[model samples]
Target: METLSNLECFARAAATGSFSSAAKQLGLTPSAVSRNVAMLERNLAVRLFHRTTRKLTLTEAGERLADSIRSNLEGLQDAIAEASDQQQEPSGVLKVSMASVFGMDYVLPLLPGFLTAYPKIRIDWQLDNRHVDLVAEGYDAAIGRGSELTPGTISRTLARVRIVAVASPAYMKARRPPASPQDLAGLDLIDMRSTRTGRLVQWMLRDEHGNEAVSPVGERIIFDDPGGLCKAAALGLGAAFVATSHALPYLQRGELIQLLPDWSADGGPISIYYANRRYLPPKTRVFVDYVADAFRDQDLAGRF
Candidate 1:
């Protein structure tokens, strides 16, 4: 049991890359977390972390061992936790990840009510655009546009995100509004530059007539964040392609106008994602169900 506890401490530290963070999660002090990791290394006869003043990183052996043990250690912990608590109510810290813009626009609003409903569940939410390894990173769930996820990722569809072309009324007044998908070429288009690929995001649109238009690659204005591009368009910088979910407020307030309303590319479903666990933690289970219920209540599930 002591060895298992030490291994748990070591895995948490490796996942978070900080003794303080791991200690907080483990309900222990930083020194205790550090000592536990040291004890783990001593028992295994292998150095785990290459510790420095500025950062803590796993050594090669540490990386290999962490990879092997993170999921297994979590499973063991979950089984023990399930047996001890019997899961009468959702409790403990729940870690979740989502895209910043989406979470702010949609998920953030649901938090207050959820907290009121499940006071025992403490949420630790992370807004990040990059792909996350849920089990490896100790995240309970992730919400965002559902694409291909890692193996063992189970997803629930929350809503369908539709991509639309938008521009400020003042900006549209300067040029004839895009009568068709191809007319977008005439506008000063603000588009996103993909951080992962370092290239412009491709815009493919289709009209009700089934006529398709592909956005030009070398757009004049390129922004790294999608939200930034939308703001630029709202400021009359130019027309930008954005998720309708995020642009709804600006459109509703008459700050921006939707162009080619009948034409929108399917942006895919906004999904709630979690690992497929043999023993689902009560906190994680309730959070997923709560969000799904909220989406259904709002009629937002699979609807733009």
Candidate 2:
């Protein structure tokens, strides 16, 4: 047990590059973490760290040990957790990342039920519109549009995200409702600026028969956020292309109306991503299943 504790302290310090940072993560004082690492070095009879006031660097032996244990340590911890009280119920902080609007609208609503079911689990939900390196960033899970999968991570499809053209009733009333996507070229168009890239996103619309076409953007009013784009369209600014998840509430309230409903763009699946492990943590496992079930129950896949 002492050896395991020392290994954890050493691994954390190696990964974080500071005793203070490791202490913060492990709920120990800096001196305690430092002592643990020192004890580990003495037990192994190997110099592990090149320490200075400003920085901590691993020695050759330390780097080798860190590399060897990096993957195995989590599995050992999971094994330990599985044998502990966590086996009875899911517990610990489930760190999740999701888009702001979608998280608030969809996943956030499930929190009450989730908490009621697993009272010991704590939520560390971060809402942002960025592609995150799940393992590197220490995120237990992420929910958003599909991206290139990380090597040690896997994605579970929650819903097929569909992008549709929408406009306020007043905006459509003033202009002819687009019979085809080409008609959008003549009207004022709200555009979504790519959050990752500085360029305006071109809308590629597909019909029921699997035919596809690109809609031109006027670039009159551009927003980085889908919610903002929907809001702009609702204010009678122009027709905008946005995901169904972002447009659903507005459409329900009569704030926005779908145009050329037969034509929509494939925005890719909304997936919940997590580490691919031999033994998935109970907290993460339950959270993923809960969210998947919620989406299934609501028929979001069919709707979006």
Instruction: Name the best candidate (by TM-score).
Output: 2
Worst 10 residues of 2 by lDDT: 80-89
Give the local distance difference test score of model 2.
0.87
Q: What's the lDDT for candidate 1?
A: 0.83
User: TM-score of each candidate?
Assistant: 0.81, 0.84
Please give, for residues 1-304, the per-residue lDDT of candidate 1 as tens digits.
4488798888888878999878876789999999999988888889999999989999999999989987787788778877965837888898999988878877898999989988998879998776687755668899977457876688998888788999999988858877787788777889787766787887677777887877644378888777887789899998888888778888989999999898888778888899887768788888899889988988765436
Which residue pairs collide, candidate 2?
none
What ranges in model 2 sit over 4 Å off? 13-25, 29-61, 85-87
**C-alpha lDDT (0 to 100) for residue 129 of candidate 1:** 75
Give the per-residue lDDT digits (tens) of candidate 2, residues 83-163.
774436788888899999989988898999999999999989999888886755668899988588977799999988889
RMSD of each: 3.3, 3.0
